[model samples]
Target: MRRVRTTHLVLALRGLGRRRVRDAALSVLAPVVACCAALAGLTAWAGAGRAGSPTRVRVTEGRVLLPSVGVPETAAFFRIANEGGSADTLVRITARDVPGDVTLSQHRMERGDMAYRSEIDSVSVAAGERLAMSPVGVDLTVPVPSKAWRSGDLVPFTLEFRRSGPVRVLAVVVRPGTVSPQ
Candidate 1:
């Protein structure tokens, strides 16, 4: 009787195994495929982010000229490096110490003479591009504060962008007629 029972159990297991090999393979493969798909989706989501965002835009070689005598404002220059994957635009800049909004200006040549003109619009920065702001290029005109400002001082300014929002950077005050300060 015990041998008969053992034989019956072996037959039952053999019949189950032979029923459908495809079904068994699919049961194991379905979970693996689902897990692989989920991992792929997570990887793509992690890699997807707006390029040239505020977090990725770095201000380098930045400086602001000391307010010169009889000069109502001074220009702030910097090398804005966009290290991200998307383009961005600088919309506004401000300093509480200054009276009003900082103006974005660019130098344009007309008949071999370069003149200053207010941008009146945002300046675009391409992804992975370096925007060099200098005395002869695009720059920010910061108004003189009520207090006397001199060289070697630091001025705080908040730069706002269309996509990256606001970023605060300290600009060192350099002497007048200086273009790049370190």
Candidate 2:
């Protein structure tokens, strides 16, 4: 009877030891598994929308000039750069702050020093080139809102492209004849 009791005690001790070892191993592996899961999530997020193509179009230096005294319209300018291997066309410009549709217009000087403004459909930017819009050249004609505009207001504008999709930018509002705050 004493021998039987000793054998049972030894077996119970061995089972407890095995359970402790397994618990230690699981505790050490928990953090490693969590880290691996976090790394995989980050990798998947970074690879989204960049599988086979690169972002090659960049828009910068955006500014909007406030309308002068009695003028009912204003102009916005931007510097668009295309760093890709092919050319891209700027298809549309939209502003949430303004109520009316923003239109692309060109300003040209005629024979008598008079300025002519005409609405254009689209503008193209060549590869490895930049298109700078100024008051004397290509610009976006924005209708003046009913509310009074301050000098240092910020306006959001979205520029859509043929191949590069949509690029969003914030344009600074400046009084007419004031230098841009780019």
Candidate 3:
């Protein structure tokens, strides 16, 4: 009787092992397929971000000066670098603390006199070239006189671009002879 019971137990164990062979293989396959799917999804998301983004828009230099009220207007100078692989435009700029609105202006000598004009929409900055918006040649003017800004006072402003959007910065007001901050 003991020998018959032992043979029955051995047959039951063999049946259990045969039933799990397919299930054991599927467990490993499930994890492998899930990992591959996750990797594919991440790769596609990264590609989409790169396709839409512009390469880079940077502020090389920005400064604001303090001069006498009789000067008519004060100017801020900046150097914008468009490192993006494509061309972009400096569309508009705004300064809030200033008493008047901002305008992009250019100065040129015509017929033995200095001619000044406003830049309306945008200033093009080529892919690799630099756009130098200087106070002397190309200037950004405040239409009215602002409250006197002391040295070291921070002037906050935003420069808007065509493709890259707006960049906010603080222009440190300094004396005429003092060095400007970066």
Q: Provide backbone clash counts, one per model.
A: 2, 0, 0
Off by over 4 Å in 2: 1-55, 179-182
How much is the lDDT of residue 136 in candidate 3?
Answer: 48
Q: Return the lDDT, model 2, position 43.
A: 82
lDDT of 2: 0.87
Tens-digit lDDT track of model 1 for 55-140? 36887766888887877887889788878777789999888788877989887767857565666677888877889987777899
Q: TM-scores, in order shown?
A: 0.66, 0.67, 0.61
Task: Name every residue pair that clashes in candidate 2.
Answer: none
Model 2 residue 21 distance off true place after TM-score fit, in angstroms: 89
User: Over the stretch 1-182, how does candidate 3's per-residue lDDT look in tens digits?
Assistant: 99999999999988888879867888889999999999888788567554344647787556777766667667777888887766788878898887777888776657867665666566788765677766446667764345677777778889888888899978777566453323
In the range 68-130, model 2's lDDT, one tens digit per residue, is: 877788999999999876678999999998979999999888998999999999999986789
RMSD of each: 11.1, 16.3, 14.8
lDDT of each: 0.80, 0.87, 0.73
